[model samples]
Structure formats: structure tokens, C-alpha cells
Target: MNLLAQTTNRVPWQRLTTAYGRGTDIPRLMETGQYEEIANLIEHQSTLWQATPWALLILLRELAKQKPDKVSSKEVQLYLAVASAITVDHMDSQDTVGTMNELLDEKYLWPEDEDEDELLWEEEEPPGYAKEAFFSYYYFSYLLLKDAIPIYTAIMNGNDKLAPAIRELLLLLEPEGVSE
Candidate 1:
């Protein structure tokens, strides 16, 4: 399926939670290209939601289509910067993988064992769904955005005007070298 179709159909958006509440409004916002609102919904006070990474995946895919240029609006640039900042904030400290393992050990959500789509779309969500969502925030955000490193690198190399925002983004994408 195409990216657009995946954006609309890949996940149970409503069963997901955002900063404010359920992500039922997310699909409509995405369809309308309401990115600023989307940013706000995904991250708030530097806290990421279950919907953050999914929404961000779609947003970055759209951004990847654009050629880097000086003409992109401040709102677009700001949103990119904010998204990168919040994502890195988690990457720097959160032990998402470990926490997720613990959640699984506790029988929180069986994303690893069950079909994720089926688990996400269940008529009644599992009891630990909300907590799992909370703990998985950083994990999914890091996992999804890590794949967009090349896209961010290309945009950064193509346009100097976006350097600051793109630099912040790369901090998340480009791994730091460790001293032996």
C-alpha cells in the first residue's frame, strides 16, 4: 500500500492517545494538512504521546518529498524543530527498550507476540494499553524517527537556511561517537 493509504489505514488512530486525549481527530487533521495542530497533539510540554511517532512518520514522509529551500514557512520550520527537540529529549535519557521489555514481562501489551494491528484494533482495549502507550512513547518515537535519518541528512545537506532546525534533528539521527 501507498504511504497515504498506510497513514490512513495502518493504525487504529482512535485507540491511540495523544497529549490531549484520544487520537480520533488525528486522521482528519492529517488529511487537511493541519501540521501545527498535529505537532501540538503529538507532543506537549516535551512529553510524547502514543500517537507522536505515527503522526511524525507521516509528517516526515511528506517533508521528505520537498526539496530543501529557503521558502518553507516559519510554521513548518518551527514544527520540525519542535518535533526534533522533543524526540531527542527522550532519546538522550529514556530507556525505552528496557521499559518495553519490562512491560512485556509484566504482560502489559503483547505487541511482540500478537499481531499488532489486531491488538490495536480490539473492540475493548487491553487493560494495560494506556500504560503501555505511556511507556512506549519514547520507544516508538525513537524507532520510527531513526529510520528517517537519511531524509533529514539529505534535507540538511541541501539547504543551509534550515541548518539550525535540521541540526537539532540530526542530533537525534546521527549517533554520537564513543571514546574507547
Candidate 2:
């Protein structure tokens, strides 16, 4: 399906875009570099809780569509795990240990039967630089994924007011040494 058609067919996308366009001043906030303000608006006006799941699903669905043969089952599992970790449950639940364990297990492109903690800690200690690099990569990935939906919707709707700020943020989050 075409990109627009694929986007419109998803209920979550429709709801998120509708709520954002009508209730949130994304354009103004983006234009002004008021990320905190925009975040507050999203928290109050948009169905953000619902949108997170929908966004992850949409990303995986799009990936599947683009490369159905290459998108392995392990990748899908990892996507779901990462999405779960970033969702509301992360804050509300006491089972973070179990949840994070699940996340580590699924995140590997190749599924490993061993426990994640074993690989992360029990094995030889990873160099400090490696750990720092891993943390940086994960942090930037989270930021991009979290911000992608709003930015994309804003641009698609001709909301140029926020475009420059969004582009700036995207640039900042882009991996080191990578050119926009």
C-alpha cells in the first residue's frame, strides 16, 4: 500500500494525528523550540498511551511491508520488547527487572537462548568505552522513535511552523559522524 494509505488505515495513526492537529499546538511549539511545552500538550491532549503501542506497531508493520522476507521473527519480538519497556508499564509496574530481562533477550538480531544478564554481566567485563557507546546508541534510538510520529505528522500536514525545530532535533539525535 502507498505510505499515506498505509498510515490512514491504522486507527492509532488517525487518532494520534487528529488529536495532535486539533488539540496540541505542535506547530507553534516546534517553531519555538519549546519541546517541554509540546510534551506537556501531548501528555494532556493526545492519546499518548495508546499512541505508543500504535507507533511501535506501525513501525514494525512498515518494516514488514518494506522487507517482509528479511524482517525476521526475532526482530519483531525485539521491537515489541523495546516498545513495552518504553510504555506506561515501565513507570507503573514493579516488575522492571523481568521487563528489562525480556528487552535484552529480544533486542539481539539473533535470538540467544541464554539469559541476558549472563551475556551483559556474567561474561567478561565490557570496556568502559563500549558500555558508554552502547548507552549513547540506545538513548538516541529511543529519542528518535519517540519523537518520530509527531514530527512526521506535523510535516505531512504542512505544519511548517515546527519543521525547522524538528529537523534540528532530528539532526542532534542522528548518530555521531553521520551527515543529514
Candidate 3:
């Protein structure tokens, strides 16, 4: 199944807008690589709609299609940076946390093994579900990059709440030499 298609199909195309104008008009903007419009309109202060990530994802896809040579991983890094900044601000609200929790569960990607019979201190086998969930936040999202931002912030700023998982996200984006 095409995940991007699945997500975009659910969008209320008429309701979403960007810096250049409505998201429906993205195709027009993409002809010229409306990069600025995407950067400006995709974000709403520190909040991002589910459409936001989808928009950037679309932009990346379009860029690849139009001129694959012009596309760069920087686009991915920059988009995440912007979304990550806003996600930090949104993290202050319980609503974001609640939404995050619900999504994690719904996605069947929750990291923890909730069965009480499982010992809390037990050392489980390698590569458990938590390992998978750690990676999921980097790839999946219907709520924009909200789930990614705070976890990234936590990893970057050492928030500790989602430290291990967020650290996993950071590793995906981190430069090889930056470890020093």
C-alpha cells in the first residue's frame, strides 16, 4: 500500500493551506519548485497539522520527480528541524502528549510490553518492540511531525522522558562525525 497515497487521500484538500496558498495549489507551485511557499505555509507557529508532514513529503517526492539531481537530504533535515522546533513548543500541552499516546497505540507500535506478568526488571531478548517503535516515529506520521519533534528535542536537549527512543531518532539524522 502506498502510505503517502493513504494519508493524502484522507486530507480535506480544500481545507488545507500553505504559505503560497491552498495545498490543492501545490502542483502549480511545484512546477516552479515553490520551496518558499512550502516552508512558509506548511507551518502554523509551533503547531503542524497532519497535512504538514504530508506536504513536505509530497514536496520531496515532487522534487525527485521533477529534478532528482536537485533534491538533497538537506530537505529532509531542514523540514524536520522546523517541525522539531514547533514540536518542542507544542510539547508543553497535554493534548499533544495525549494525541501522541493515542497514535502510538493505534499504530500498534507502542514500545512497552504491558503484560503485568512480564517482570519489570526482566532483561528481554534483543530487538524487542520498543526497538521497532523507536524507529517508527522517524517514518510514520498522520499528525505531521508532532511525534517526531519532542522526541527529537528530548534527544537533542536531553529531555529524558523519551530519551532512549528519541535518541534513536537523532541517530538517524545525526552526522557521522558529530558524535565527537
* Tens digits of per-residue lDDT for model 2, 61-148: 3443432333333333333233323433222224222221122222321222223523543445421113332332233234434444
> lDDT per model, in order?
0.57, 0.34, 0.40
In terms of TM-score, the best-performing candidate is: 1
Q: What's the lDDT of the predicted structure labeled candidate 3?
A: 0.40
Q: Which segments of candidate 1 are over 4 A away from where they belong?
A: 1-9, 70-133, 172-180
In the order shown, what is each candidate's alpha-carbon RMSD? Answer: 8.4, 16.8, 16.3
Model 3 vs. true fold: TM: 0.38
Name model 2 segments beyond 4 Å from true. 1-140, 143-157, 176-180
TM-score of 2: 0.24
Instruction: Point out the worst 10-residue segment of candidate 1 by lDDT.
Output: 1-10
**Tens digit per residue, CA lDDT, model 1, 1-180:** 122223343555655566676677988987777767877888777667666666766766677787777325443553453445443335443434443224223343334333465455564755345644455666555655666666667767887877767676656454451111
Q: In model 3, what are the clashing residue pairs, if there are any?
A: 18-41, 19-41
Candidate 2: the clashing residue pairs are none
Window of ten residues with lowest summed lDDT in model 3: 125-134
Tens digits of per-residue lDDT for model 3 on 62-86? 4334332344334444454444434
True lDDT of residue 156, candidate 1? 72
